[model samples]
Target: MPPATPPSPARRPGYGERRGELVQAAIRVVAAQGIAGLSHRSVAREAGVTHGLVRHHFGTMTSLIAEALDTILPQSLRRNPVSLLLADPGYPEEDLVSWIDEQADLQVFEYEVLLATRHTPELRPLAERLYRGYEDSVRSAFAEHDLPAPADAHVTLILAAIEGLVLHRVTFRRDDGPTITAAFVALREAIRLAVAADGAPST
Candidate 1:
């Protein structure tokens, strides 16, 4: 008989640090393996923590996923689309696309968690609040550009469009630059036309 190998030492809890660490690890896990592969053990393995710590830090698995979204939402909204349309966020960054490329995992993880929110009722409110923040940025961005933005209902549609664009490209790993550029061009034109029709003064 072969000799029994010793088990690897159990990872120690991060205590307060585990909250943030686990959230980020969960994001990486989802990005690397997709949301379907996310599990307590998977996240623990990614986070280098014992599996029990996942349950300890986050009572429900869904809550951990929700927190991961919460963690990345602010980074996603760090600068409004208008800022990128004008110039990059400035200093310590190049542009939104650059930032997205740099944080590809986080960005991809964001959409995955977003899909999870669609079916997870308990996590939906957190998603809604996070979305409101993005919406606020969208409203502010257009307003700053003196552009007429969509109303709440229409804003939802626009957001869906933007989401689809990013999701499709990111999922396929396609570099359809012209198509993506044209989409933004169309969006800018629409905003400009709407503002013009509204007879709004330009900023």
Candidate 2:
């Protein structure tokens, strides 16, 4: 008889790093397949580990998805409004073009997440939280321009327009960055001017 081979040691790193990788893998899988297609086995396979590894780390599907959302949502926010605001903290009029570019890039990723969320319960809260944080940030950024503030509906509309533009560009057209940014810059400036002149959030 051939000599018995010893079992291989687990290649996974320490808890924190391994967990982070698993979460990231979950994001990729979700992006590619949507929530309906995700499973512990699939994510584990994507991460090059066993299904047991995913279960061991995440415990439940909901918990795992939530953690994944936590990781992804922040980046989504950063990609658009967050990064745009960060680039020009003093709100330089000349930098509006740059802000629009950043925002458009951010929207591409956001729409992907939104598509995934449609089928994943774990992603609902994540989406909600992202919207909340985004709205707050938009309000703050407008406030910085010596504006009163936008109502939730107005903020939602602006966000929707940015996202809708990205989705349309992705689905029906090519990379329309310059055109989209020009439109967004004009709209954002108009909003800022309106808010400033009104001296309060519009209802």
Per residue, candidate 1 scores C-alpha lDDT tens digits across 1-203 of: 99999999998655667698898898888899988989899999998879997888887777887777777877776756544553333222224345445677877887776777777777677777888877777677767755566467645655665666566557776676556666666655564554455555547
Per-candidate TM-scores read 0.74, 0.68
lDDT of 2 by residue, 1-203 (tens): 99999999878588999999888777667656656657899899899999999999998867876676566556655534523533444344334444434444334435666676777666677778777777777777666555556667677777776566556655554656567666656666655554565564448
In model 1, the runs with Cα more than 4 Å from the true position are 1-16, 86-96, 145-150, 198-203
Q: What is the C-alpha lDDT of each candidate?
A: 0.70, 0.64
What lDDT would candidate 2 get against the real structure?
0.64
Query: Which number leads on TM-score?
Result: 1
The residue pairs in collision within model 1 are none
Clashes of each: 0, 0
Model 1 reaches what TM-score against the true structure?
Answer: 0.74
